[model samples]
Target: MNIIQIDRHSGQTSSQILAKAMDLHASGDLHEAEKEYLAVIARGYRVTEILPLLAGIATINGDLQVALDRWTTFLDLKPSHLFGLMEKGALLHRLGRWQEAVVSLQAAERIDPNNPDLLLNLGIALIDAGRGHEAVTVLKRVADIRPGNPLVAHQIRRISSAIVPFWHIPMLNDQPRNDAFEEGIKQAIAAHGSTARVLDIGAGSGLLSMMAARAGAQNIVCCESVGIIAEVAKKIISANGYADQIKLVPKNSKDLMVGENLDKRADILVSEILSSDLLSESVLSTFEDAIDRLVHEEATIVPRAITALGCLIESDVLAKYAFVDEVSGFDVAAFTELAPTRLPVHGKLTSWRRLSDTHDLVHIDLRARKHEASYRQVDLPVTADGIAMGIMQWIRVDVAEGVEFSNPPDHYSDGGWLQVVHTFSRPISVKAGDQFALIAGHDRTSLILMPAG
Candidate 1:
């Protein structure tokens, strides 16, 4: 594939030319050094070494294609050249040849699988190639090799942030949600017996699967779509001694097949895929698919019900997301239409007064086979006299009989979950004892709440 295939030019003075090239290269005279290296290369005297020197000189002189061609030529002569592959990959990445960059680095990786530098280059190229999940897996291996390397850690963090949602790390730290899920899993095992096949959707860090294992559920299949998370979850599950009991699959729940990705239909379903306002994670569709295709009839579903609860509130901070009137000297109220429909709010930190008592915005029974997106009008009982900005919503998970969790605004400050404020098209005025009409429901993927006449 390289055009630099020249016939060997045998000469008596080849050694002399190579020595002068080395001297010129060391003296930083790259232009002169390149000439001599080319002379040595043309003479077929240590062409491999001379080619790399000539390529490096071309790269320094800003002739990347020439450098790439030289590397390609060298590789054609000696395809298994390890450093050549790495250099070629790095150059390919710089040239925005994404997939080719990954392929080259991967070739180098196959030769020296555990070399940290090679792995690092491969990981970076994978990110640029849009293979973020695999990049993260590779970067994690680099981290294991060079523990204190800041660049690898930063790359891992950057790639992870781009691929995984920000809430997962915090969600893992949500003790109440964790405790409720564990309790529910324990009860399910008690009722279904330890041998019941369990499916954990949105496996995340494999926490729920591990919980099922702790409760003595022997057969667990957990699925997570994100590659890096799935790989790290395997390590965590193994570290916790549940590797044999739990099987992790990097796939969406909808794509999983019974008897293929699962032994049979699941007998117990353990999942915490509920979003902040309850449905933003596509919980309805995801659960519906699993119930229809993956889980068996009468499967014990954790959090048999979820409630989206909220109160109409007034907040100066939240108003900014809803409306704008005078800026400089213009009637900019129309600009409010371009504002965000909803925003995540930390209940304790956000300044707001409830205009009405918390009401059930929407509720879904997880055991239901299907959910239809629908809306209904609610007569919210106003408890105070204030301007109603919008509805401030949170979630309640009824895991089991006595195991339930709700991240109410006043208490759930640190959880990965946050109360979402669905800003109204315009702020509405209300008074104590006035029943405010509101439209409330979900589009299946997000909670929808707005003002009603």
Candidate 2:
């Protein structure tokens, strides 16, 4: 087909040029349509209407930057234009400019707060920008407006997976953990008196704070780093009738101030920030900071001590995930180095056989003012003859003096704490009577597990 060349000498009107541009755009001749649209804009003919069409054509032509520029220009003319803002924001998101997209979508959200489409886009931008907590909040609003929307629910789940671990729900329902923490709170109140000021760090669902309040603690401060979790904790604390007694601080424990955030240092400190691998949640630094800046010299610490316990394991199922050698007759053992060092495994769901008796790998004193990373070598007597895949590790929490909780893989079925598999570089074969030397410790934020040479 030949190009439809417009003759400037024929006195073509702006309306005529716009009609030709629309016809070319409808016929899928975007290049010609863009030229005609530009001519129409130059003549100042229906600039607002033609600009969006030109932008759409640019988008269709695979010129995203051009499309973004066109939409930006249209927005300048009509700052309050709803669709203009939406297009600009959406374009920015496609271009991988997440923060810019968030800014634009936020403006659109301000214009129409109840619009589900705007909220959905804004939530996506927030997630892309590594703001999953904020995304969850925005997406929850979307769910409220459009009930039973599967996409909203799916997005919420996706964001939740990234922000919160899978074990939190089960942990919340763990009767033993709850009972242990409650007992510890009661003991703390008994020792420090009911009026003692309490500090709860990593206040997930505000369960510990409510426990303290129920134990007759008059003043309590709880801090949660995740904003969404903190908001939900507020609701839970309020619903449980402890809102007045418990103060919710939506910031990290490291940021809490003694005089400004709290009237004085707390008399009792309680926290449930322990991870499956013990130190993954920065519990060491958090507790150390609390002891330094947020707690008194003799503050009663719940879970006064924690220990990382583990046993050697052997499993074909776990081996498939941890180490891979050959695939389709090709040696890919090198790929095993790229595998995750630590894997969260459901205690009851995963199949594995213990090859050695459980032993304490590391111990942490919660009352200590400072901590340094340390490693130690220990020998474990093998109880079974099998190929060693890794060590399955769990945590033992000594909450107060008498209350204690341990998530051993054999008896602990349902809880937030999943047993972690610390995989070795390669599988080792051993006999029942063999003794295995192992190195274990922590680097403040993660557990270190390896076989000793």
Candidate 3:
């Protein structure tokens, strides 16, 4: 009876300590709350729940190390505890331990597969770990589940952007990205002459607007969304003696107002907003919004349309860029799991083969009277004999009157953007007269190509 009394007394004391901790925590006295929580934990009371609260307080107070320790303790006591697992994973991510975070979050996901938050966190963790392609797979799921979530959408854009190979930037400069604009500008000028009111979205280096001005445009409003780049563009416009003819708006394509930024609706719309893979920069939405809200209905859009070109190609050269196979007589296959990336790829530098000769992917008609979402299954006929590596993509621009340009596969050569070759897992061998079906669409920020029937 005496031993029972002692046990009851101990339980009462533990309960009292937990109550005090809860009260303090509820009152926002986290430091005092922490003390009480520790006291309850020391007394062996509700370790799972109390430890998470302690970890939460620590996390909120910016004591990350303490939070990590507390979360670890909670997980040890309750390994499959969903909240505890997520807290620990998030903490690991905060500490830049991306791989560890992915494992933890993935475990948590296995425990609770329907949790969108867990999936989003896992995607973020994967991205931080440098597994961009993998991250895209996870993030795309999140996007489908939470269509209006900007953050999830942003992550999708980020991952889609990274799928491009890196070596193409220098090569892009050598291509005709700028020259295409120049030709388009001259055409727009000849069509409208000096009387044309021009709007240039994404005015990189202010080159397109200056080209417009040189082609004799008056009342040219050039909007560059990047501040630093806009500043440089402003200087370039001044240097090129077209500053008086051009007005620069240092804001995003969406931030510009029709009346506030321009006296009248633009007669000609000029923009160099095409990224390597076409939609990586949300050119579809930007053009749609600009056209619907900012520009006139009949406004001539430079690069009136852009065709997103893609093809199945094979490359032994691209192996190193996309995968880590053999390294110094060691097979570090596990390390490939930690690979990081978040940008488009250029196929020019990588050793690859055109399994099925280049094919056109989806094309966004920027000059359409109305913009709408659409998708179609495309059957690409293989006209060449080669191993199909993956989709090689580029943009073919219909700049202006009689000015047609293409970032041909032979050249990842262009300015500001390069043609991206998205490699597949394994090469698909094909010969002349072979055909493969693929589903292709533009989701505002990404051009998706998936295998179809």
Candidate 4:
């Protein structure tokens, strides 16, 4: 049997008030319990102990603001209070004050560095604060401490996917593309000799820089904009015994300074920033900036030209992904407007029938001082009778003199480059021997493909 607590209005000892507060809290009379706890604080008795209890009660009552204030007061009294800092950080995180939560959690981390709970909270706060690179670094430590923790592994994967594209590893494994770039790099080094300075703009994996080093280039500069990837590249370069010959610049090539970062303009410029669609990686602007500011006037550019090649395609699977006319017996053709204009599809993975012969859509000269957007309309004679989905596009790289690489759908497989399908506004039924007019061009950074009426 339980008895109701009696109210003493005046001259109660602080301990008596605290005992009554705990009794009220235990009885689920939170409102009165909060008043009794405040009375204890007012009487200046065991405030540090009472504040945490009050804060926990406030949190349970959905009074987050009051809880935050109580925790803040407790921290003021005991600045290095570990549990106070942890609770404050967790509260700030719930309140969406991510940076403040990170600060508080990090302070707690310094006090208890090996605590997995503190590290997990800090990682989440860093992620919500848009500091994904740092979050991954912190979460990796958590993974080490709690090995095979699915939550930690899941967080690390989610952050990695958000930060890097899936094709990066496959691109590194692309032998043909790697060989072509290596050949161009070696040829350039043969011509320029060991004194030539080689600049690799997007040194993904530092492969090209290592190639240059192996080819007797004494000076090589590799730049990768992503911080985590740059750190990985540094490790790989060091492991390959080229750390002394190659210097890694963990910044965008645009941010590089001439006299401070480089002794002189590079004699050879190498970059593989080309996307599956040829220009989606901002290759034009990046290359233009390099030519104008980062390289010698006569610098030998690897992949001196890139051409966009495309063919009309018809695929039931592609049509399903690109268009919608009816769904569950509902006339949802209007929903087709929301379909993606361009979708990357693996040439070997996706099944599509070619409706027309492959043709050159557009070509970019890497060494040109400047580029202007241009469009052209071409007539393609359809060779097959089918429903037209859109143009399936690929890339051909002229990587230096006598070195070329093309990812045409017919022959190329298991490479980093995937064909991009430019979806039409609507599906069109076509017959063999019909001439189809198609519009193709670029908007400086992306290739444009459209059906011409």
Note the clash tally of each candidate.
0, 1, 17, 0
lDDT for model 1: 0.89
TM-score head-to-head 1 vs 4, winner: 4
lDDT of 2: 0.91
lDDT of 2 at 137: 92
Per-candidate local distance difference test: 0.89, 0.91, 0.76, 0.92
Off by over 4 Å in 1: 1-58, 63-84, 143-148, 157-166, 238-244, 328-335, 431-435
TM-score, cand. 1: 0.80
Candidate 1 vs 2: which has more TM-score: 2
TM-score of each: 0.80, 0.90, 0.58, 0.91
Candidate 2 is scored at a TM of 0.90
Worst 10 residues of 4 by lDDT: 4-13
Segments in model 4 whose C-alpha atoms lie over 4 Å from true places? 1-8, 26-31, 42-48, 73-81, 110-115, 141-154
At residue 390, give the lDDT of candidate 1.
Answer: 88
How far off is model 1, as Cα RMSD? 5.7
Local error of candidate 4 at residue 183 (angstroms): 1.0
lDDT of 3 by residue, 48-115 (tens): 77877888898899999899998898777788989888989999999989999999999999998878
Writing each residue's lDDT as its tens digit, candidate 4 over 1-453 gives 999786664777888888999999999999999999998898788999999999999999888988999999999999999999999999999999999999999999999998998999999999999999999999999999999999999999999789888889899889999999999998999998899988999898899899999999989998999988898899999999999999999999999988977889999999999999999888999999999999999899997999999999999998888899878989999989999999888888889999999999899999998999988998889999999999999999999888999998877887888989999999998899999999989999888899987
lDDT tens digits, residue span 1-453, model 2: 999988672788888888898899899888988899999898787999999998998888789999999999999999988899999999999999999999999988889999999999999999999989989999999999999999999999888877876677898999999999999999999999988999999998999999999989999999999887888899999999998999999999999898888999999999999988899878889999999999999899998999999999998998988899989999999999998898889878988999999999999998999989989997899999999989999999999887889999998887778899999999999889998999998888888899998
Error of 2 at 403 (Å): 2.6
